[model samples]
Target: MFELTRYDGRRRVRGSIALSVGLSALAAMVIWVYPSFEAEVDLDQLLAAYPDPILQVMGVQTMTSLGGFLSFELYTFGWVIMLGLYLAYSTAGTIADDVDRGRMDVLLSMPLSRRRLVAERFAAMAVPIVGANLLPPVVVFIGARLIDHPLAATDVLAVHLLSIPYLFACAGIGLLASVVFDRAAIAQRVALGVTFALFLSESLLTGTDAETVGSIAPMRYYDPNAVLLEGHYDLVGAGMLVAMTLAFLVASQLWFGRTDIH
Candidate 1:
């Protein structure tokens, strides 16, 4: 199991490291620029001028503080869209690539069970996502402190810590797609489409009559903006994310267990 996890981890390690470094730099840069915004604009007035839908999509409620700014500029858009899509793309090929290349037969011929194989591969997918999620908060925290904005350490920690299950749920969707489709490209497309669509639905339908529809999206329960900016950690929301992730993983295991990989 550990070997299977390491094998997948090694394949994606370089790319994951690059992404983490890039996000950290970006977070620092974003925090660095916060002072200028504070000096220039009447943020509350500026934010109020935007339509509610735009504000909701942008994830900026109050622009009076550093936490709100970072939540809006860095975590909400960058992590939700960029990191989420990257995970989908990375995991979408995990199972399909092996099957497509005829490596699944050789692996299955060994002592590995199909259920264990899928679980280990999913665990491997978590490595990059967890690493990517962990690095940005440190950069953001240090940058905030350097700029004298001084976000609470607990808020900084909560933002990244709570995001893990969300990323896992996103990866689980891709893993399920990878096993269902024999072609990696097709799996990737499906995963990307589903993930983005869910995000868009959550973004658009939230706080409206159609919120029930949005509730079905995994992204609905994972709001780093709430955690980082408002200091509101939704334990129930985090629990829901965990439940959804487990559901996806179980479905993946069962599906892969019954799959006919030639």
Candidate 2:
């Protein structure tokens, strides 16, 4: 059996350095921009456009002020989901890489079972995906602290807690693609495409006054501003995200088990 967890840890540390760098820059920019204050445009009109049902579905508070912009970092659900998507893009290749290079065949010739190989490959992918998913928020949080404008730490932590499942969702998406496609590049495209669709759905749903549509996107359950900046918690919304992650992950694992890699 492949000692999957140990190999995963080493690769995760090496690959996720890029994730740390990218997110650090993003967090710095966000914090750097925090101080360049300007009056919000047409505050009254914008506030008037606030739709409650969508807000309920998206899990955010309506804000039309400078303060809200600081919290806007969190409200922008697309970015967080995108972060996970990027991690998936960076990862989705463990088994495919081996298979394409003839390494899997060599490894399979050993005592390791096919299922053991899959589990190890998945573990290798998961570690870095988790690290990449986590690094940005921490960098942002630290930047906020340095600037002395660290918004609600507890609330942001709460939001990140919610983000856990979202990251898993991305991983599951990639895993599903991995099983369905024999090629790594194709699986990557599938993962990224699906993630983009989710983001698009959230954008379209939030743009409309309709709560019905927004509820369909997993991203809709999290409003970064409310959870990470404003210190709001939505247990029900978080639950939905976790549930979706579970569904995707279980389905992907089963599919992977049935797949015959040649």
Candidate 3:
């Protein structure tokens, strides 16, 4: 029944592994450099020199501790921005690429309903999202311990767990774009552009008068600093992200079901 899901999920395994390893390597590098960085620079003074907007956008609450450093250097940029964008870019190609290459007609000729196809294809995105989230915490925790900056295991796990919904929400945006555009390249570009714009809006407009406009952005709900540095998991925000994912998924299914393939 879920043949499409299994096929797509299997296809993503190698890429997901490569992504996990690459992120682990980056985490190791960041952890390895912390001691030297701490010795060579005044974190407080350096952070103070940056404008408030820049700090807020980077999710840099502090840089004096290992958790804070990893939060700002690794999770904020690696997980929040890079991983989020990767998923959006990957998911953006799913349906659109199939359509662009005339594979959609072949798939539609099978027993699968449009909704099931969309749902299962979207479900396949979990392979990468979960893989990327699952391995990094172990690496981060071990790297921290090796560097004599042991982190709370629970906090590291919480950060990755919370990121799942955030990543799914990002993929949902790509899914919407995938259905809207027939060309994979065009859909991918649009999805990347929209996701990044949302990220910028959330980062730049938080305390400003236009903050309300940024509330719709999924990035606004996921705060790595809150999880890693403060040990505060935002369950409410995760729930909101899950809701946004479902909304985007439903919207995509509806639009795809009605649209003409040609």
Candidate 4:
């Protein structure tokens, strides 16, 4: 099991490193420029001019502070869209690519059952996602301190730590799509489309009478803005994300186990 996980994880090494570096750099840049923005823009005035729905959609209650700015720009948009898409895109090919390239036969002939094979492959997807999620907080913390706008360390830590489960859920969705679709590229497209659609749905539904509809989307549970800016860590929400992740993984394993790999 460990060997299978290592082999699958090795394929994502370059991508994982690149994503970590990219997001960490972005976090540093966002934090580094806080002073300049604070000096120029009247954030409270500007944010107040916007409607509540607009603010809700943007996942920002305020932009006058470093934490708020980071929540809006880096956490809500950058991490949610960029990291979420990357996870979905990467995981979408984990199973589908092997099956499409006829590599599943050789893999299965190694005395591994389909359940273990799919579970191991799905589990390995966490390596890169978790790696990419970790570096940004360190960079953000350092940059914030340098800029004299240091965020609460616990809040920063909470946001990143809680993000893993949400991202894992997203990857599981993509993994399930990979198993359902025959072509890796097609699976990737499907995963990307669904992930983006859910994001949009959640954003649009927020603050509306139909906000309950957004509950179905994972983004509703994973609010970095709330965690970092308001210091509100939703334990129940995090647990729900974990449940969703497990459900998707189990479904993928069961489906892959019963279906024809070819």
TM-score of each: 0.94, 0.75, 0.98, 0.94
Residue 107's C-alpha lDDT in candidate 2?
Answer: 69
The alpha-carbon deviation from the true structure for residue 252 of candidate 2, after best TM-score superposition, in angstroms, is 2.7
TM-score attained by model 3: 0.98
Q: Report the lDDT of model 3 for residue 194.
A: 96
- Cα TM-score of candidate 4: 0.94
Residue-wise C-alpha lDDT for candidate 2, range 146-174, written one tens digit per residue: 76665566765665667666666666667
Comparing 2 and 4 on lDDT, the stronger one = 4
lDDT of each: 0.85, 0.63, 0.93, 0.86
The candidate, 1 or 2, that scores higher on lDDT is 1
Indicate which candidate wins on lDDT. Answer: 3
Sort the candidates on TM-score, descending order: 3, 4, 1, 2
lDDT of 3: 0.93
Q: Is candidate 1 or candidate 2 better by TM-score?
A: 1
Look at candidate 2 and tell me the lDDT of residue 9.
Answer: 65
lDDT of 3 by residue, 1-262 (tens): 9999999999999999999989989998999999999999999999999999899888788999999998889988998899889999999999999999999999999998999999999999999999987777898999899989899999999999999999999999999999999999999999999999999899999888999999999988888788877789999999999999999999999999999998
Which ten contiguous residues of candidate 2 have the minimum total lDDT? 58-67
